[model samples]
Target chain A: MRTIELSDRQEKIIEIVKESGPITGEKIADRLNLTRATLRPDLAILTMAGFLDARPRVGYFYTGKSSTQLLSESVNKIKVNEYKSIPVVVNENVSIYDAIVTMFLEDVGTLFVVDDKSLLVGVLSRKDCLRASIGKQELNSVPVHIIMTRMPNITTCKSDDLLIDVAEKLIEKQIDSIPIVKEKEEGLEVIGRVTKSNITKAFVTLFKKD
Target chain B: MRTIELSDRQEKIIEIVKESGPITGEKIADRLNLTRATLRPDLAILTMAGFLDARPRVGYFYTGKSSTQLLSESVNKIKVNEYKSIPVVVNENVSIYDAIVTMFLEDVGTLFVVDDKSLLVGVLSRKDCLRASIGKQELNSVPVHIIMTRMPNITTCKSDDLLIDVAEKLIEKQIDSIPIVKEKEEGLEVIGRVTKSNITKAFVTLFKKD
Candidate 1:
């Protein structure tokens, strides 16, 4: 159950494979300015350690083990709530044009449309506004509710979901972000937003382990 | 200015607001059951055109004329990329204990490792032979170079690159998924991976209007 430790040289080799994988052993040794003989053991040790892969005719490559290791580690470390950001909102009575402006001013891609109760009832995005505008639709008279994506079917994530799980949902669903919602006695209310940028930040922190 | 055409209800509101904005009107007749009678004229016109804001006691709010309407529209029309599945890998010579068992038997993760040539050296997964019967430091003595993250930074994607830009890179980043990479001649080797279930997928497809 002892953890395997890597020497600096081995680490470099692993990094190189990870960087330029599916390369030849001779090429790796040449890049490092070491004799194939000198690099062979380094390569062998790395391969034995589950960091590199060697093929008969093909050169060496770095394995995908790093991602799994990273994923397993990320699951244990990141708390879901920490990754959420406050949701951007607009009033239900607001014009579709106004919603579009709000999206730009806030520098966010999506906007949540809410009622007087502050309960999320619909969602709007740049796309909805564009479609409306291109159709030469009346700007001042069109209510966003007509074009907004309604609730329930909206993709949402809970505050307790793990970062890894969130990442999985993003990829599987091919979504740019997920609305974080909380259930109250009346209905579901949007509390925050989790976007692709958040996942990237979380991964960067996770990978910087000592 | 020639006003855009709108639904009957929308047209009436626009006509009312063009003459009476910043003025709250009560009991305005609207078509169907869709209209609320006690609504503000400016708020109705602005909200529909993407320009009005609302406050609690202050009634409807207006933020001047809207700008950057085109940009929001463009963002909405952009197409998203699909997620693809790729194998996970690990080095061979490294300790087979922690990795071999945890990732392999799971049947979900794969392991890639590299050799001196930098070619895809070896491919291991939950199905790899050494999952059970894990030994002591013998695992450490084994080199991962034989089993680790492999060449080409497989699953590599680019920054500033759109979703489809790295769909191919997903297969290259030697792990269970493709990692987002910065644009570089070396293909921006995997900095962070895009998995089959990442949020990008949802943005790429589900939310897309097409």
Candidate 2:
């Protein structure tokens, strides 16, 4: 097998394809701010190299040798810390109404419930807030802790945990995100979070690596 | 790379690992109704073959080259129809009360709203019911269509769409599941549903194949 190092354009193209594949060359060209004629060489190279598969009218799909190797390397080599985003934190004592505002403001599906010391205590999801706020009129008086999934029950990942394992935990638990915590004397410290979006980012980076 | 054919027992072990990895051989044996002693050889073979990775205290994880290949192939080869589950359907005219009951009974996160002719019209999710039911006193009179995401905006997949592409759609849309539909004279006929669980199943099957 010939190892053809991908150029920046090629890498960017692969990233685009990975994200919204079964896409056309025209669309790919549009995303990269390039004309179809300018992208022909990269398209030909990617499709021929098996990094992409193109049907006559169906456009390009990511069905390549790299898909296998990249997925393998991602599972084995990438760790939770590598992809964890800063966790959206909220105090357990905060009113459910306040928590609702925070959740929407942060644009996160799940919020890490923390104590004053920043110790991870529980998790509040969109469903929890929505359920709690509905049917009642006391959103302000209701504490978030009442609706949160408390610790020791929440699925968490340490910084060193494999990305593959974290992804598995996400699927197994059917949760949107996993808090990346540090086990401390006080409790688990919420340093970061790994979300479903992180996995998608990983997929893009898998192709981005030259 | 040596292509070792997996025995049925080996395949089952891989399945268990994919579902819940970092599992101990003793646990695997217990689940399969075999003694730890009897399962040692298979575990050893798998570990030695690099299909399973074992740590002193971490137990076993699926870390094979095929995991990458399998993930790639699973996404590329498998279509929405192949692993799509039976969809939960409800008539658009059904009361929110009736829809809520059906949602619980079917154990589904979303319901396909169909017309009297069983043509897909809209989709209702757990959030929809939760939101509509809250602050409302007349679930019996309120119809589900009021809260549902109507068609032309619903994220859907055809039976022939690749599983990988479908997974992308799920993440991009951040929805629970996508209805696998077939275009018919009536409209888009809901055939089945594909979910995140289906992706995990594909992951296991990738290793299960000989």
The C-alpha local distance difference test score for the whole of candidate 1 amounts to: 0.53
For model 1 chain A, the run of ten residues with the poorest summed lDDT: A67-76
Residue-wise C-alpha lDDT for candidate 1, range B132-181, written one tens digit per residue: 22112355455654444444424444444444334323323323345443
TM-score of chain B of each: 0.33, 0.64
Docking class of 1: incorrect
Is model 2 an incorrect, acceptable, medium or high docking prediction?
Answer: incorrect
- Per TM-score, the best of the predicted structures is 2
Looking at model 1, residue B125 earns an lDDT score of 37
Report model 1's interface C-alpha RMSD after superposition on the true interface residues: 28.0
lDDT of 2: 0.75
Model 1 off-target regions past 4 Å? A1-3, A6-71, A208-210, B1-210
Candidate 1 residue-wise lDDT, A170-191, digit = tens: 6665555678888888877888
In order, what lDDT does every prediction score? 0.53, 0.75
The fraction of reference A/B contacts recovered in model 2 reads 0.07
